[model samples]
Target: MTKLIGALDQGTTSTRFVIFDDTGAIVTFHQIEFEQHYPHPGWVEHDPFELLDSCRLCIEHAVNKLIKLGYQVSDIEGIGITNQRETTIAWDKKTGQPLYPAIVWSDVRTQNTVDQLSKKSPKGVDALRSICGLPLTTYFSAIKLRWLLDHVPAVAQAREHDRLVFSTVDSWLIFHLTGGLENDGVFVTDVTNASRTMLMDIHSLSWSNESIRFFGFEGIELPQIKSSSCIYGHIKQGALTGFAIAGCLGDQQAALVGQKCFETGTAKNTYGTGCFMLFNLGDAIPPVLSHNGLLTTVAYQLGKDQRPVYALEGSVAVGGSSINWLRDNMHLISDHHQLNELAASVEDTGGVYFVTAFGGLFAPYWKVDARGTICGLTQYTTRAHLARATLEAACYQSKAVLDAMNKDSGTPLRALNVDGGMSNSDLCMQIQANLLGDGVLVTRPKMRETTALGSAIAAGLALGVWKDLNDLDKVNKEGETVFRSQLSAESTERLYSGWQKAVTRSLDWAEPVDEKLE
Candidate 1:
């Protein structure tokens, strides 16, 4: 019987379940798009029940598809989970009920909380960077958790009762999958996810007492941190019952593993709802933190005894979601495919530049006060130019991150392995290559479901289906499309310069206001 692994990819906008054979080829899969709740300006949320139900539905549907293909559920040796990191969830350990809506990672409602915390720290927002590998920003879990405790009465009540359990999406899923309130479900988080919380000591791979006190979360219950690839628990009920849940990783770090970037100096950029670029730094944690606004994060820990791998990550707050903005908000295109078609119709942005700081800029510039801005627009500009500019906005942000990575690493990124939704566009890839300039390559694998494949690999590693990283040599190595610079260095520089100017117009657009916790 062929060994199969199931990977659950719970993301910002959707959830998916994929079953992969031992060779890394996908056998079956199912994806469901869930509702995104925006209660207030700059705030984002999701129904915790809705997220959990979507995962259950995706798993059932995928397993059904696998059965139709004459495969048994027993053929699947284990399961892995990869999720959106820093999206905070609070629940009651006694009843297993969510205290409030999941506070999305993109939500800037905690800006006031961030400001207050920054004031308390002598080093300001960067006081915790040396310990947690993250700044005290609204982009992390600890900040979101802080907001919940300060504002939400239910969360505060749960804490008062000593029933509050705080975790990212991964631990929430694992807890329910293992047993929930009935069986006393295992509550745990992997190093990659914990590293995003601004609560974990990156070097120790454990929760930091200093960070916990700094955030004033001394009494709150945090999930135990574990290796990225290990048997977290097993499904107690459902079609996947008794299957070992072996692996867990944050979505971007999972993409790094999926891309097989095992060597130092290797990197991959995932352009999903947001763009994340991670450059592997190998075994040791760097003593110094990034001065260029990039975050230091754990890449992965394959086993409990294995040494943790580290990375320098650059996050772009907007990526393919900018295309969604053009479609849903501006009504420029009916769908993403139409956006690409319209963009290809235009030669260039026609001197227009768009700064997609919808939730403020991240990486290379932690401008929480920044807002979206479009500059250099003229009467000559059309919908086509706007569409192309939207796409170019993502590419420009990615290039900015790549440049910052080069500066921090002291080595130029020669090639970037690309994946996720935006990478499917040939036009977008060409634009990215054009901006990256000569000698740099952007490679996209034919198997674009790398996020899922990565989790499957992690699961398989723990289950001994594959012994080590070298064992995955032939997995997902079938074929790839490589893109090189098509534009001159002068043109690339000019375009980037305009993008920089547009970004400047976006900074400090929103004034700091005291947000009421209602």
Candidate 2:
């Protein structure tokens, strides 16, 4: 019988399912986009049920396609999950229903609470950042968790009843897929996912006692901490029945693993709705650096006894999402893909620079109130110019992350492993190389769904279907497009300085700025 690997990719925008054959080629796949909830300005959320349904639909659709092609359902060996890292969900453990909407990673509802906590703490914000490699920012899950417990009535009720359970999306899915806490299976999260929660000790790779106490949570409410590559549980029933639930990691970590970046100094950048750059920093817990908002987090832990891997992450709140804003909010383009073509048409941005600060600046800035801005606009500014500027903005934002990683780690990066939708654009990859003044390695996946492939890598290892990362790396393809920088340091630095100035103006401008696209 042939072997197959299955993965559930639960992202901020949607869920995807994929089946990879023994050679690591994708046999069948499905995807579904789900609804997002924005209760107020600076807030982002999702209905847990809607999120789950999207996964269910994707799984059924993808598997059914393979079955029609004469693939046996029993060929699936293990299931792995990769999810949006910081979205928090509170639910009733017994009834298995969410008490409130899932608070998305991008939401800033807890900014005020974060402020109060920083003021009261002795070492202030710097102290916490030292401990977690994350600043006292509202983008993290801890502040969001605190806010929901305080403001949401149902959440408060369940907490009082000892029936409330909390998790980022990964834990929620595991509970439901494994028949919930009532059915004997319990809640747990992988080290990569747990590190982003802020409630976990980044050094120890466990839930922090001080953090839980600070959040005002008592005993028995927390979930177990598990390795990224281990058997989590089994799906008692679903389209994927009897399959061992083998692997789980946050979306970004999965991307890192999918690229097989096991060695330190290797990194991967995902240019999805947002751009997130992560570097494997080995297991050292370096002290937080000055002013940069970079997060020191768990890259992934293979097992309980294995030494945990660490990483530094830099995130840009809007990447491809800015292109969507151009289409949906400004009506500048008929199709979003026009961005790639339109950008390619322009030799340059023609003096224009777009600061895609839609949800504020993350990693190296940590400011929550920043707004988007398009600078150096003139009568010459056409759609092509703006499109070029948008692409440049994504590259520029990632460059800032690379700069921060250098500061935090003390060694400059030699090259970057790039993936995600934007990485497909050769022009964007060239711009990325020019700005970073380093080589950009673009791995065009045999499967475009690398997020799903990553999950399979993790899950397969845990189920003993795959032995180690070396086993996954054997199937991990090696073909890549390499963009080496030819630009002088003087030229690169000059352009980066201009990008910084444009971002300065974009900050805290909650209202619109007038600049006609002629």
Q: What are the RMSDs of all candidates, in order?
A: 1.1, 4.0
Instruction: For model 2, give the 10-residue run with minimal summed lDDT.
Output: 509-518
User: TM-score for each prediction?
Assistant: 0.98, 0.94
Predicted candidate 1 versus true structure: per-residue lDDT over 152-225, tens digit per residue: 89999999989999989999999989988799789999999999999999999989999999988878889999
Give every collision pair in model 1: none
Worst 10 residues of 1 by lDDT: 509-518
State the lDDT of candidate 2 residue by residue for 1-518, as single tens digits: 66898999999887889888766788888989888776677678899989877877888898899899998888888788999989988888768888888999987667777777788678776546655666677777877777887778888889888888878889888877886656766488888888887778877777788777766777537678899888888876668866778889899988888877788888888888899888888875553444566877888887667788888889988888788789988998877678889998988898899988777888777766687888999999998999999999999989988888888777677768777778888888888988887444444554446677778888877766777667765675755567877688898999999999988887876543111111
lDDT of 2 at 329: 84
Top model by TM-score, which number? Answer: 1
